[model samples]
Target: MKKVHLGLDVGGTASRWVACDPDGQVVARGSVDGATAHVFNPAERQRLGTALAQMAAALVAEDLVAVGMVGGLTGFGSAAAAEIAALAKEALGLAPAQLLLTDDIVLAFAAQFQPGEGHLISAGTGSIGVHVAADGKMTRVGGRGILIDDAGSGSWIALRALDAIYRVLDRTGSLAEVQRLAGALFALVGGSEWHHVRQYVYGGDRGRIGALAVGVAQAAEAGDATALQILAEAGAELARLAQALQTRAGDRPIALIGGVLNLHGSIGTEIQNRLPGTPISQPNSDTALAAARLQASGEEHAWRAILASMLTPPVPSLGSSVSAAAP
Candidate 1:
């Protein structure tokens, strides 16, 4: 039987798994619904376990044995780390020594840079800046989650767009001026009624809300001024995260990662404008694959080299625009 190392990148919006052989060749890969590491929450814990089981079953069906597993999970604080680790071990059929778990941001940083080499700005469902020093100390800025405002994140952008749309309605009693944005957002929400927006915002999880960022991006692409401004502000907010980390970690190169950066070009451009002369690269490498390589090599330097070799050009947008119909 062929043995493989498993790497899992589990976030609020998506969970991806990659299996790599000893020679660092990808053997299998899969993705499932996203889950967080806040295992103390019963619902989240169940989602995490289910996602792990799904990935494990897929590997088993492919006749691959997992010898080691590394997982990077969102909300992987100390409070629920042990429980989450145990869940992964049981679901993936790995022993305690064969498993390593960490925060998703840490995994993302490792995928892009070796410790002390640079700072990482990740803007997904949430936003955060992370710097891991050579001495093994980690500094983090922002990423407080949606409740406290993960500024410049997908969720933040979605919230800002919704807030703006409603404000326009309140003042003008119509969405005529911001019809493009309003229509885009309402389409995602499934209705333009107040109850629809209220239910979607209050009844669903953060991931569901974060998904609305797509509509905001779409509206911006269609030349909606409000949507464009929101995205630009998001970029500035993300830059603030990088800047905060710079104050403590010094001026290191910045690596931007996450779905939010992929939403539009303006976010990346705004970040560059705010921090001139700072080297920023959005390396295109799979975080799960990087985790697998890291687990296989057990050496950060070796994993970093492997990750660097896989870097591709920055992601490009389709440049397609959607026509918005008023709701």
Candidate 2:
């Protein structure tokens, strides 16, 4: 039996595992809830560890090669990816085996164009644009969520939707579409009044806004003007992030990932037009593999040197136009 490689992707709501054979073909897989959370107490950690261990055990074989993580940043902060990578290795009981892991965003980037030219704008519940130069040097250009600076993101859009409702309540105007989604969100969280939201406003519960984002998008898809506008603005901000990167990085290939940017018609199209460039496609392998390759390269000692190498050969290119894999 040959050892396989495992790739774990922890999104805001779920964690998934992708097992790969020696030839890099994805074979077995597993996932579970409780993978997405902003802050975790001991209970959360235990749940997470159990989920990971169970997934690994279920998918592992004598042929399994290594295990890597693409998400699960948690409270790790700036070193989120690296921290989660190591933590996942230990949690999976694969510490001594070869493990390749990194952030979900990195995986998204690589999924498009590894070591390729251009900027990538990812807008799901969160938003960020990353630029990996032909020179292997990866620079984070955007990705400050709403708390700090996410101008266009699911959170921003959801808040806007809520604001639209507030405006309607004030008799300012009617955001007809928001009525449904906002009500749905409040209902899900057991809050039926504005006071409930007000009391929890600054308490750091991200589930409400994060989850409401999907509803907003749904309304927009169903032809809600306010929802469309919100997404349009979000798309614009996402575009700006790409523009900023392109302006700074000499016109690299720009790849769009995340559900927000991929929204149909007006929003996504508008974004592409605003940020002019030939769109580079997504690749077959996940971007985590790209980041894993980077990690395997041991570029931590000299990131600049590693980036310079990317410039020399193996340019990034995507073979596909679009993919539905959510970030």
Candidate 3:
């Protein structure tokens, strides 16, 4: 029998789902815009569950799997993976074929690292590095985001921008180049009087922090002194993050994904310069497509075992090791 399956990718700043036939050709796709990852919110969490239900009604399927950051990596996100599996398995009450939950990086690694001699670095709202060696030994670094990790991430750039802004506001520093960029942030467009910049900064930490990278880059391109500083700082941080990964990682191809690395001079140059001669390439496929591959593959990866062993209930708090707001 031909196997038709559904794969879900609940990742940073967005929620996405895909349906694929046994041949791995995509049949349907669904997506929702999210600033703070719905898996972290109760009300929004239903968006994923509901979307899956709707997809189930539309198509007959054999298996449905949701992979990505839903793994119990962080505390609040701990149950996201299982909750999704449960919803598909229990809530939607769909007959299960093979259901699996996992971290987003693992799927990307599976899709990109065919020979398994590579490291997948995801830099977006946050950043994480996963290494798949020739022997299939996986080592992850810098996945904690702005709080603990995410060194080359967008939020990391934004935090540096904020620091530059603070430095300027306090008159403790000079951002002659970055000032113009900061002005854009405060400046308004058209006749609209909405002060989204101010509101965004004050609204919440996770909400604005990750997305701030875009604005910072905009300012830097415009010759904003402070914005350039922010980008430079982020570039350095990106290098350091890459350095840490390269040091620990054995010889492997390094694949860089997410918005931060895509930009030419700002971050890519920094990372490439720091980690010279390393194989840094683009994502072979998107996270959603990777999710679909993982969905179709029935083999249970060892990543799940690591997650289960690490998260033995009563997860440790963010104590002194990490500050409250990641940014």
Candidate 4:
């Protein structure tokens, strides 16, 4: 009987799982809504937890003997890892040693590079940088939760855009550029009224709010100075993250991952220029694929070699467009 291993990437926007045999052959794959232990809304947190538990329960095979599972989950920290581990074991009937939970950034980093040295700057609803040393010790930067930190993240860009919109509404800024960008932002948010924007801002979850950055990116493409500044600043902040990691983890190829970078626009180019290397590019695989590779090998150094066989070769390095609506 072939041994089965499970890999999971649980994120704020979506979650993915893969079950594979020892040869790294995927036997089953599934996905569901995102899961997060860290969220402003408790109900949202519970919903995430339920989604994770249900996904795990549905994927686990009862007949498998002592299955191994590696989960790279967003918003999962030391405090919550044990609980999440417990939930997985309870739902899947696995033992303690069989389940391992780690920061999703680590999985991303592992996926992007081989056993050697490298850094990762990932932005989604939030942002973080992880540096894996040649010796495999990991150093983390700027995953301090969304409220205070997460500079250069999607939420950060969206918040800045919203601030500009409010400043325009209040006539707080005299610059015509600011006003023009603010109007664009207002229309981007919904365009009904200030009250509507306010409601959307306050009531929306982090993922929803972060998504607004896409509009900001679009506005920048269309020659909006404010939006350009925001993307430039975001790129700079992400560069700072890479620099900080480099200071400790040594200079290495830095992989940029996130929707912002995926847009492959000024923001992405800015990140590549900000970093201290050649050929700045996206990660070879997403978090879920990384998680699957990790579970299949259980070797910290096997990510690149294992995944190379499974994933398609990354697209040749290339470059976003300007649009009223964000894609």
Best by TM-score: 1
**Candidates ranked by TM-score:** 1, 4, 3, 2
Q: What are the RMSDs of all candidates, in order?
A: 9.9, 8.0, 5.4, 9.8
Give the lDDT of residue 58 in candidate 2.
Answer: 73
The C-alpha local distance difference test score for the whole of candidate 1 amounts to: 0.84
Model 2: how far residue 105 lies from native, Å: 1.5
Q: Pick the candidate with the highest lDDT.
A: 1
What is the lDDT ranking, best to worst? 1, 4, 3, 2
- lDDT for each residue of candidate 3 in 70-90, tens digit (9 for 90 to 100): 121122234455556566665
TM-scores for all candidates: the values are 0.89, 0.72, 0.75, 0.80
- Clashing residue pairs, backbone N/CA/C < 3 A, model 3: 68-104, 177-224, 177-225, 178-224, 178-225, 178-226, 178-227, 179-225, 181-224
Clashes of each: 0, 19, 9, 0
lDDT tens digits by residue: candidate 1, 150-212: 899999999999999989999999999899999999999999999999999999988899999
Q: Which residue runs of candidate 3 sit more than 4 Å off their true CA positions?
A: 1-3, 33-47, 57-82, 91-97, 133-137, 172-177, 187-198, 205-207, 297-327
Colliding pairs, model 4 = none
Residues 50-71 of candidate 2 have per-residue lDDT tens digits of 6667765675543454543333
lDDT of each: 0.84, 0.57, 0.58, 0.69
lDDT of 4 by residue, 11-126 (tens): 77788887777777777777877776553457755766687676665664443433777777765555565666666666666775676666577677767776455677888778
